[model samples]
Target: MDFGANWKHYDQAIIPLPPDHPITARTLSGIPGPGTLRIGSSGWTRKEYTNTLYPKGVSTANQLTEYGRIFQCVELNATHYKIYSPAEVQKWVEKVKNKDFLFCPKYPQSISHHSSLLNATDETNAFLDGIRAFGNQLGPVFLQLGEQFSPARKATLFKYLESLPEDIDFFVEVRHADWYNNPTELREYFKTLREMCIGAVITDTPGRRDCLHMGLTTPDVFLRFVTKGNHPADLKRLLEWKPRLDAWTAAGLERIFFFLHVHEGEHEAAFYKEVKEVFGIATQETQMSLF
Candidate 1:
């Protein structure tokens, strides 16, 4: 969210590119009909959500259970900081078992940012092993290449990506400016994803418009939407995504994991309430399918 913080320092305007051309399935393959759209926040334990999303005096230990009753999924960011024990993973899994919920964990920072995806076999193995405990409750496990990683270090990226187990789905978010600046490199980057059957994480933030490359390496789409506040500008930017998401859904895009990030202290409940309305995504009443 901090990456493209234009308004924080800018005479420059926060102009999102006009919508891209309609996204068609890259190949002949696709899901049978309109696919699922999973809408959620980056986390559910926000104090802002207390009493509004959570009960007025819900215990901290019971928050995740309450969170499962509302949102369809979560960006399980706690996993990004470190490898967790299997018992802890199972404890989380137990809380949401009644609902068709998913825990979309991220690559642990120890493996991803600290070791930078080199010779961290023990860490990688332990991380993957622990998350696999989610069993059927697992969503796509996403890996974000460090901002310092670039096309120059693609071999390391690919090696790690290719080594990932096929059973669990994955999406990759590349932050390097090089991946988006050059058309040829971008094409090759996506081509590799298609070959490997991994998806791409399309990010839309104010300062870093290039990260909003709307390409689909796989049918499933994971979107990271960062907004400034409840300002009209923020709503306008979110509205821009409606048509693009609509087109993809009509084209049978499999899943949409839309995570909204706004500066803390803003009314997040209001922000996402409006987002759900604008996107015409499911309301909590319609969440019987847990999507």
Candidate 2:
């Protein structure tokens, strides 16, 4: 969660950026068909969510079940720090069993952070083997390269991505600024993802507006929306996304995975409610109160 903590100072600062080009949507039109949209927070194990996002005295072990009662999906951030065993992954699967929930797990740090995509096959295979325990419940596996990872290592990154099992979905989030600033590299990066059918993660944060490159290389989108604790600007930003989402859905984007990151757990639930309202997604009543 502290991946981009350096930008925390910009939480209250607003930067105006131009609207997304229609051409980007036009390019995304090549996607085959319309996809389902899933909205949820990063994780559901926060102790602070006890009464606000979870029922009072709700056990930590049961939070995922409680969370699945409301949200359809969650970004499994725990895997980003350490790889888990198949048993552990299965435990998670059972926790959300019988619910229409999906888990988008981040790639293990061994593959993404420690090694920088070089000779990561062993670690990648181990990570994937564990996550595959989710079976049909597994969503996209996200590989978030550290900010130090630059375009200079694009070949290594691409090679690693190409080696992934084609049956499973995968996404990549590059934090290096050069990847966004260099026109040729950006185009090539996306073009390669399109060719490989790998989804590109679009991160919407305060300081790094350029990371909000509305390009969809695949039919699906994995959006990381970092909020400033339910700030008014947060709602405004989601409102702006509503129309774009509609357009993308209409234009053949298959699956949309939206994960909200807020400083407080209550803000996360509040924002989720607002997102559902704005997008007209239905949800059942839950015990969590956003007060």
Candidate 3:
């Protein structure tokens, strides 16, 4: 959650940019089809969320169960730092088994950071094998390359991506400005991902506007929206997204995983509420258990 903490002080200086013209034009042209949209925060266990996101007296053990009652999905951030055993991932799967929930786990640092996605077959397999325990509840597994993972190493990166198991869904986030700044490279990169059936993550944060590159390489979208502690501009950004999302849905985008990043857990719920109200997207209702 503190990934973008350095930019916190610049909150007042951040101004929302106008919509990306190419994306807007495409959306308006209509790519007709039905789609599924899931909106939720990165994680739900923060103690600060007590009585707001979670019930006042809710125990740590029951947080995920309670979170499933409201949000349809969550981004599992803990996995990025440590690899979980299959049994451990299964425990999480059991917690939200009855609810219509999805868990989007991040790639472990051993593979993405430490090993740098090169010649780390054993670590990669171990991570994938463990997360496969989520079965049907598994969402996209995102590989967040470090800021130093530049375009120079793109061949190695693409090779690593091609090596990933095809059955599991995967998305990638590249922080290198080269990927966004160069028009030809950007188009080619997106085209390659589309052909491979992988996804590109579109990040929206104050410090980096270029990271908000609005391109859909696949039918699905993985949006990482970093908010400035419930600032009014956060609401404004979400409002702007409403039309863009509606257009994407109309144009046949299949799924959207919108993960909000806010230090205050309470702000997540507030943001989701605004998205629902403004976009007319319905919040998912939990299924009742027969037991």
Per-residue lDDT of 1-291 in model 2, one digit per residue for the tens?
544534557546454444653335645765556668888777888766778768999987899998887677888989988889999999998988555799999888887888887877778778988998988999898889999999999989888888889999999999999998998899889888888988889888877777888888877889988776667777777777777777777778788898888865556656666777777763455223322
For residue 206, give model 2's deviation from the true position in Å. Answer: 0.9
Task: Give me the runs in candidate 3 sitting further than 4 Å from their true place.
Answer: 2-31, 281-291
Residue pairs clashing, model 3 = 31-251
Residues 93-195 of candidate 1: C-alpha lDDT, one tens digit per residue: 8887455888899889888888889998899899989998998899999898788888998888888889888999999999999998988888888888889
* lDDT score at residue 274, model 3, on the 0-100 scale: 67
What TM-scores do the predictions have? 0.90, 0.90, 0.88
lDDT of each: 0.79, 0.79, 0.78
- lDDT per residue for candidate 3 within 1-291, as digits (tens), equals 555544556556455554553533333335665668787777868775678667789998999888887778888888998988899999998887455699999999989999898779988988998999988899999999998888888898889988988899999999988988897778777777777888889888877778888877777789988875567777777777777777788877778898878766656555556666665654443111101
TM-score of 2: 0.90
Prediction 1 global C-alpha lDDT: 0.79
